[model samples]
Target chain A: MACSCVAAHLFHGGDFGMSVVIQQIVTGLSIGGVYALLAVGYALIYSVFDFSNFAFGCVMMVSAFVAYYSILAGCSVAMGIALAIAVGILFSVFIELIAYRPLRKKNTSRLFLMITGIGIDMAVTNTAVNLLGANYRPFPNVSVTEPIMMGNIAVGKIDIIALIVSLVALGILWVFLEKTKPGLAIRASAYDTSTAGIMGINVNQVSIIVFVISGVVAAIAGIFFGMKYAIYPSMGTVSTKAFIASVIGGLGNLEGAVIGGIILGLLETFVSGYISSTYRDLFSYGLLILVLLFMPGGLLAKSKSDKL
Target chain B: MKRKLLALLLAAAMVLSLAACGSKEGSDLPGITAGKTIKIGFVGFLSGQDAYLGQGAKMALEDYIEELNAKGGILGKKVELIAYDIGMDPNTETANACNRLIQQDKVVAIIGPESTEQAMVAIPIVTEGKVPMVVTTASNPLVTVAEDGTLNKYMYRMCFTDPYQGTALANFAYNDLGLRNTAFLGDVTNIYCEGIQNCYRDEFTKIGGSIATEEGMMASDVDFRAQLTTIAESGADSILLATGSYKVVSFVAKQMRQLGLDLTLLGVDGWYANELLDLAGPELEGSFMTNMVSDDDPIFADYIEKFTAKHPGTTPNVYAYYALDAMMSIEWAINQAGVANSTEIMNKLETMKDVPVFTDKLTIEPDTHNPHNKTVSIIQITDSQFKTYKLYTPEDK
Candidate 1:
């Protein structure tokens, strides 16, 4: 009886109108934009190395912490963001040099490389749990609190900023990858590292550059997330969604990663808005399963021979 | 010859360590006080995110034991404490801690475990072990009472139940805040959240208040914009966050502000932690929460003074208050029976009435083994500091 009463009130009194729909769409796009940042970086690394850098999540977490303490230590917000990116780049490169490079030098199997990435992720997350006490540290109000109302629809300034920043960053990355000589070298390495090396492309240089790019995007994603929510050690778990998004896109395709993230975000918001929030994760994972079963190579699947 | 010598040394060392452990485990009969000390075991999370509760409880127990030993130990035997960290895993870790405390430590009684999940895991073990436990702040009714309405004979709790807290908050919301419609934002994965959410929903609806939306999330979820966006559209004047996870609470608060939905936030004892302030100070300003104790409560003045002196630069959270009460209540029961026996202690506790604790007077109801007629405090955040707004006693159901 009580459930029905609540349901009746929700349907009749509550406004499920056009403005609400617009708000949900804006929220979805903002979240999708952040997911796209992480997914693109993840895809970039996978495209070059043929392994998922699961430790990318920990890099994001550490960068957020750096940003938090830096700002607390009297640095301006801009400085804080810059410091976060710098730390992210440094940590990612450090992990590669110490952990991955040693294993790669041994001519280790790809499975071993993936496992090492997972090991690094666990080690870093646990170390963070011990060093930084498990507490949520919220970012100071960096974005304007006032909502921009366009007719009936209300949008926060942070959401708009997130969208614009994601687009510009991804656009710059697209141009760099398509037009630059180094980008060509990196792409050639992704296609065939041995062939790229034989043709005078610096394979080792490509590896470091890819990691550097991954770190930049991870830092940007981490900052946006920390600003949106509070930052804790396990906040890196957001990368799980990014991982799922990247998988839903073809694993090695940059464009597919972006589309997959946007699609995931839109579906999550629409489900939560119309149906129930409980089923939102269920739908996302279910979609992943469906994609895997029907289209194992993902929505933008390359030919089997090309992937091999 | 060298290999033989190394093997022999390893064997001898292992045997000696085994002997040391054997001696440490006092006697075969549990709680008989074989040696000069009466052992008391404490099981709580000393690591991970919820470590604050367990560590605080451990400190309070250690302090109480020190004071008790100085005043001449229970029944003239020096009191000994053996504490274990249950950590985050409830099923296995809590079970191991309770088992080791009862079997190996041979403790006369036990105190511990703050969350309802841990308490539930510990209940069956403690009951089977016949080692009475005074649980601190595990507020689910089932912690002490079963679903079949039978009392868990070996278990007792220091804080008020989730239903009581929910009812109190609902009454406060309807009567004081005068809000008619509200939304529920909670972590379904948490029993504490679910318990309070169910009760608050039933009681709030019973009193003619309508819920606009009820959104569920796991504790692992960080992004709540999707849910918040829905709540904003639902025309709800406020949101009831049923989770005690200050992490989730602070996240929801900050995200709500970012979404431009300045809905009044309602919370439970979970919001009593100081970390919430550090995380979402500005966002939580003017929000209301229900708790059993606050830092400035006069009744805890003596305890607070001693605690602050013991651990400087840290104010006692609600866990510290309840832990002190749990220790004192166990002390009272043991003193009334005049022995360090679990059965006698449980019997004495069942009929206890008007026994004073650090926070307030406690009375154990025989049927449920829960504190009866405990006062729940309504706390309002004023400029990021928690000020006690009102003291409410829920009507007996």
Candidate 2:
């Protein structure tokens, strides 16, 4: 009878429990979707080039600045978004040709690439600082202020929009990677560049295509992030947190990135609401460490292997 | 081998250039006379996460130095400011920076250590070095005052200490605005917030005002919905925001609007951002804040014109004024001392009274080295600007 009573108490106020659960789920999905986008970029570049690009954060920051400067120059919100994406594409291409291409020819070690990547990151960030004064500036608002009511829970319009757009972009990317001929060539290059080259696949062209897509994903994330939070010259540091999300989700798994991001987001919100907000990040990272201890291959690793 | 030789020559040239700069130092050196070149060092958070404050302080310093140079410098010396970026981790770097300036650079004085945390670390170093240092930011009284209630001889400050500023805000809310019941939202991570909260709490309760809710938030928190909801439901007459610009604006405006709270908002100098007005929109229109100076004051106007004429691009922030006041105060102390020695300047600085500037008519108490009889401005935000409602000098209340 006591056990039954406790269960009843836990499940009491059906509407409240349902709404709270829904709110947590929605918040997790929205933020996780953002993490998924960033992880996809990180994973794609790593898989193809076997290189860690430290300048990824700077790429995002520069894209956000492009959007900021565009809006400040009397452009509409749509124009700002377009400018960010365009700049991201251009920057990615530039970085690939200037920084990565020569190293690729030399078949540089992963460590060497990582060091060069850090140097590039510093150069880019410092250049941005020199050009734009170090101050926080707000992004032009494109989000509708109204919160869409879903039962007892409410979600902002931007949250819903970001989730939808992220899912759509991810879907398009998945199709491009699976259904197209270039997709197979890219995968072939990832597994064995020599094999791909012998099979008449232009590996260099595939690498450029991969970078372009990664840049677009990062730029979209950057634009959406700036819309939510204010932009600063060092705002790239925020991406470092997302990188943590990426690592927790599993380093090379795209789907794991999504799962990890959502789980981390939900963990943060629930902990912040119930426990101390100061310990929210602590809880998330602690959970990540615990999960790694138990599941060394990550939660979504099984799914990726099964599909492969 | 020729390429290697070229690289060697280039490196040697760079070292040679640096050595030339190194030799041309110290005011009393044969080639460097006191009236020919004045060297002052600025140590602040010039790089790292909190670089924004440093940027503002640097802008002000640049403007003030230009103005001084144009006006034939201090006693005909061309004032040259050598700045060092101490970063945010002041405990580790501030002392080293101060030592480098005093021992190696041989600057006549130093102008900053922008944050209170940085100042605390730097004060002891400057005092021990016997070099005069003027802190350009706020720290509590305990920083300068010894346990025996004597001021550190080499330390001085241009900004009002947090206790006075905090109490001034509370006094403004209770007496000037006639709001009695208040709620306090303190940032636990910041010493500034904690100091101000304590002062306001004590002063408000003493003045017959009740604090309905007292809650805390971390400095980095952007959301204050839960706290604001509690404040709104508590039936408080006003809410005291005691955080920096980013969190203060977003949390107050968004949460207040969300909860439909009609309480008057009051803040300290932390709310002095044009972006805050933009972000907060109509929510900040009738808000009151206690500040040290307002941009529209005639004293500030003359300074602004002079600053603008000299430094054409950078807009003068409040920190610039404080930085200017800091350097100028040191120049004045040195002029009064009529000597280059640290002890002579320290002696003159301790007994400084009625030092007039664009910001205030400051008089330093001999015992505390703190500005006595200073003026505080009560500003109201209307149409996204600070309109000075009242200028309360020390004698006023």
Best by DockQ: 1
Segments in model 2 whose C-alpha atoms lie over 4 Å from true places? A1-30, A46-52, A100-112, A141-154, A184-202, A303-308, B1-39, B45-93, B146-150, B173-187, B204-240, B245-265, B275-283, B335-340, B392-397
| Clashing residue pairs for model 1 | none
| C-alpha TM-scores of all predictions | 0.91, 0.80
- Residue-level lDDT of model 1, residues B59-92, one tens digit each, is 7778888988999987787887788887656568
lDDT of 2 by residue, B111-177 (tens): 8876677777887788777777888765577667765787777788777778888888888888888
True contacts kept of each: 0.48, 0.01
Model 1: residues with Cα > 4 Å off, grouped in runs: A1-15, A140-146, A303-308, B1-34, B395-397
Q: Which candidate should be chosen as best, given lDDT against the real structure?
A: 1
